[model samples]
Target chain A: MAVTLSQDGRFHRQLIFINGLLPMVLMGFDAWRGKLGVNPAEFVTRATGVMTLVFLVLTLLVTPLRKLLGWNWLLKQRRLLGLFAFFYCCGHLLTYLAFDRDWQLGTVFEDVVKRRFIAVGMFSFALMVPLAVTSTNAMIKKLGGARWAQLHRLTYYITIGGVLHYYMIVKSDATYPLWFAAVVVVLLGYRVVVSLRKARERVAVGVER
Target chain B: MNPISKIPSSEITPEETFLNRRFFMKTAIWAGSAVATGGMYRAFSPRSDVKSTGSEIATVVDSTFQSSLGADEKVNSFGEIAGYNNYYEFSTDKSAVAAKAKDFVTDPWSVEVGGLVGKPRVFGLEDLLKMESEERVYRFRCVEGWSMVIPWVGFPLAKLLSLVEPRSEATHVAFETYYDLKQMPDAGSAGIDLPYVEGLRMDEAMHPLTLLATGLYGKTLPNQNGAPIRLVVPWKYGFKSIKSVVKITLTNREPPTTWSLANPGEYGFYSNVNPKVDHPRWSQAKERRIGEAGSRETLMFNGYEAQVAHLYAGMNFEEDF
Candidate 1:
């Protein structure tokens, strides 16, 4: 905090941009060099899926961090992180459809309907579509502040569903998924405590008045 | 997860050719570059790295029980076969298994035979080796939907069971692998019940294809690939082929298996490879061969139906699975 750079500076945004794209660039290099492991398709799918979850966690951290430190520019960074989460989600789904399902839409549809894990994953991805569409400045303005904030609340449910999707898919080990669940729970728990405190403060003010 | 999985057998020198002088120099060059690049052939490349000196290499003297199945499919290099493994007693990570199991001691191992058997004898490693050996090139299929072609060296399970003389009351054969909390320290965290067990009906156990393998690719079994002695039920999923086996019991009742016990809905006692019967969580209609990029549709009984389908004749595969 002693020597802070401007939170909304172009350099800061550029840094995030470069870092966000770095995973894909490295993955591409590995693919070109034939280094995506025994099952390259599996490697790509898992990498993109994990990246999506990582971005989702970062995206939710923005609101709490901004509230605690009073760094509102972090709000500006949130949308970009959310968008990157969506971007990796796209990659995850694309790899599964092309490599795993062989672009067989009928089978994929059946998978979505039949497999609980696939159904959960598809539900989360579908929830992301509306958030992504209303992410622009004009859409935010059209929806207005209170309405936009209410709609963007979907991130909480989407992140929960994302973790569930991961938990349900793994074979035996649930250690990674459990850790993801813990982080999301703590993040959500903060909001719950803050809201309760605010309500108590308002009741005290009303009694004094 | 090693990228050497993508290296085609065509690019690799054939087994006989790779054992020569020129190939030894090539291995050194490859080793230098692999170390410089920080990967690829670092751990078990060229297969010879794991076995130092010719005497340490395991050699199979006879080709007793050969199968023509998957002959067109090139046998995976010794590195690929030994490098990637699913021995849960060692580790769950396939690529990391070889390293974790390297220090494993397979000597002083003996398998006990009992329960409803007339002879019911324990055969040590030395005596087990005397029965016979074979080179079986079979398609290896994992329950998680991946595959490989392996040239396993062993004899039929019937050959070993014959020495014990199963009793008339015996209806099923139950096999259990050796489990030591100290020897396989990591197995405590493997998330499955230990002393991995598998079972087959008596007739199925006696089938010509049920192998008691001691090695692979003509070398003695590496620790990761179930050293000393292991079962090779090619028609069933890989888990049914229990590794590091210690006990064989002929029973009158169906024996509980590890995967089935872990998740009965997803894994069944009769986990034969079938294209029509998909796993509850994931589709098993197709599988990507380990070294290949694309997937091929799975075969019923893993393409050994002609030899094994009759075993499941009256049973409904969908219900049993």
Candidate 2:
């Protein structure tokens, strides 16, 4: 099915931007009001990390949804979602650095080296940097679409790494992270199925010709 | 329309003077009346039950029991201390434990003290409380890298062990937390092997600082904070202080602990609070004190090193951890 990009793309983009900012604003308000509960630092850190993963998963869902559901308008919002994921990833790291670690670079460095979850989390955030930097139209045009798409493919690995980081960090319960992992697997599975179908369709077209 | 304009500037009391006057009045009332004998002021103090979660406060006072406080340690507000807990038998979420444990019935509680003791016996909660109890404010450190200073009311474990009369063969003491599927809804789903168990070497169990806490902050232990009776081993991580204890067994071998049984490598049986020893998932060098802004350096044996260091003498700290 051929899907046309809707003229309401700008409106959708604005809505996405506001939606992305809403959690940040709410978290700030909660922090100000002592509503984050006993360990605000841990609460904020986990919240931002979860938000980052949520946005990353949503960003990944865009491609499969566009192909499977014929929702081409969803493609336009992918960059915003990816940027929001990066924003929250930064928030998660900053919360850990400023509040939890008190900006002790040495301690953080030690943790990144010693703790498996911290190391994986740091790696996932580092992977997002290039994709975030090249999210612009100019960068896409400069790098060409094929190369840009290949580079952005790091998102899949980032998502996996983020989920692993979360799964490993939790003391015992892995229910939430396992659920996130299941979602990623389903989304990735959809992509594989769509590609197989496309391959089969191409063979049918060749045979008809 | 302005309320402030109705009161003349001279007639208005300064905020400092107003607060001081209120404190003065409260002190005067507390000192001058028969209510003073009943400790009415303590019951009605602003800090007593602020944000309390409806846990009963025991009226028993151990007037003779007193202990020194740490130099700069401040008692975490009753609400904050009680509001936050990690009783996994009840729930995993720290803040959820209090509410979830509200319906838990801890009375008619009996502790079976057995194994290597000369005589195995079960004692009711009231019977245990009949023993001498004292108040000690100690720094509590959790394996999750959080800390709190708690004012615990209890007697030393040594005194209890003396009554039980452990046999010469006793090498370790193991404690089991009460686990009723009906009362603790999460017990079936907490993933840990149930009837949460913890252990200490014979010497560690007999340490002077080891307490069988019955209350906290001059109140009966909240269900969430381990009601009826619980162990309070301040030098070790908080989990070592098993909550809602039911059985204490003296054994010749190291008994399996809940966390250790779940993940032996991550949680050792001797889970003492040591800054030098780090958990595989996180650092133990520093801990975020609950209600405090920033992390502080975690102490060796949680600052009871002078008392506990000899227990681990000549042993590899990493292996013991």
Candidate 3:
């Protein structure tokens, strides 16, 4: 039974890996075929940003899913979801720097400050970097428990910045931003409720003692 | 794959995504969705893609005819006239005016100069241009955030207003853009205030800073850039520089501008690019020199304070602005 369960887990892992590579493959194929048009960088960068938001929301859903569905095992996949979110975020940032501005530092800096959309995007990128760096067990251990958790709390800011960036960049139509904002509200609400419950239990225990 | 298993797997599992599932199925579901969505967007959208269909694009008569201007008057690069736009009714996209504005009917364009004018006359584009000398290069500033210097070819608004012969009661001059909600798709959108109009105080209207542009880059103004005629107030935010103007009404009372009414805090009557007055969303400390990659420090009144600042005079800019 243990071996079979391990095999299933491995299969899921492989599935996740395949899923991650698929988008990149499709992007490459589109570029090669000249179907994606000349601005492949814009496409790739925008896709990565949207995917990052999607995965970040998914990562935040682990705790809620565990409570709602009695699926405690969902917690085990949280880090994987978070790391995938970070990966896409890195890709998004790289594409902007490499293709959008042709790796011009001055132009990139100006865009980050001068353009409202770029500024929000850069803020989101800034937040994601810290979360990505501390994702590893060694770094998490070095930062200690409370500090590590506090550092990861920057995800809330990141999600806000990402949504704002998406909103500002688009010339018109805000349905995507509205959807992401809704998901983020739910995710953050769940965290707040869970934290309140934990705090209440701690206070109750102390009073009883 | 088995749905019957009740026991939760103890081992830490990696995550999976929709794309991964699609890959396993050997189908690009995401790409398919994107293409379908794009198609739906195009089909449902009222505005036609001007670039797609070879609609009546205005002939760029003179390819190398950058307007003649003094060295001090010229910016390093006149922003891409193709992109720097004022297509208020259709859309706000910089490229939208150039791309989708050809469909706009400009041949029969006329201006109704009424209100405090002694002779309120509706003059056609041909008649109007014939009345005034060609054009002048002016810097274009947008309210949404961006600035551009364009080699605009048009005579001063003061020049035309002087010809009209205004009454003493004309304290404010209001200009209205030709607004057809059906034709200009963006007019119907909740985000924008329809029938886009802007006003200038009597002094500003009479000032040399004000222009009524008929041509740009020594060519007839592109339909997207308000081909027939448009107001160009160099010192104020771009929205104040109204476009595709069909009417100019000089009234005794100050007219409420479309932008100031839409967003009171961000856009004011005197939306001078003052570094001191930051926009609600972002700072106006630096502006990308239109057509150039690098940005320069944004000056007070977009570097036109010396000439136009006196018009504000004793009025507190912070209060009225």
DockQ for each numbered candidate: 0.14, 0.16, 0.13
Encode model 2's per-residue lDDT on A1-209: one tens digit a residue: 21222445765676677667766776677667676677778878887898899899999899878876888889888999999999999999999898767897788887788778889999999999999999999999999999999999999999999999999988876777999999999987887898899999999999999
Regions of model 2 farther than 4 Å from truth: A1-7, A200-209, B1-50, B53-69
lDDT of each: 0.81, 0.83, 0.69
Best by lDDT: 2
Candidate 3 is scored at a TM of 0.66
- As a whole number from 0 to 100, the lDDT of residue B4 in candidate 2 is 79
lDDT of 1 by residue, B1-321 (tens): 899889997897665664464446545644554344334212222122234111222435565555656544666677667766788777766666777788788888999999999998999988877766777888889888888888888888998999999999999999999898788756887878888999999998999998998877766788888988899999889989999899999999999999999999889988999989989887888988877767888889998999999998899988998
Model 2, B91-188: lDDT tens digits are 87787788788889988899999999997889987788787677878888989999889988888888888888999999999899988899897887
- TM, every model: 0.86, 0.85, 0.66
lDDT (10s digit) by residue, model 1, range A1-209? 11224443554465567667767776787678766655566667877887888899998898788888887777778888899999999999999898878888788888888899889989999999999999999999999989999998899989999999999988776767889999999999999999999999999999999
What residue pairs clash in candidate 2, if any at all? none
lDDT of 1 at B133: 76
The DockQ-based CAPRI class assigned to model 2 is: incorrect
Evaluated against the true structure, the overall lDDT of model 3 is 0.69
lDDT of 1 at B102: 82
lDDT of 2 at B164: 88
lDDT of 1 at B301: 93
> What is the Å distance of residue A134 in model 3 from its true position?
3.9
lDDT of 3 by residue, B99-149 (tens): 556677777889999999898888887776675454455666555445666
The stretch of ten residues in a row with the least summed lDDT in candidate 1 chain B is B40-49
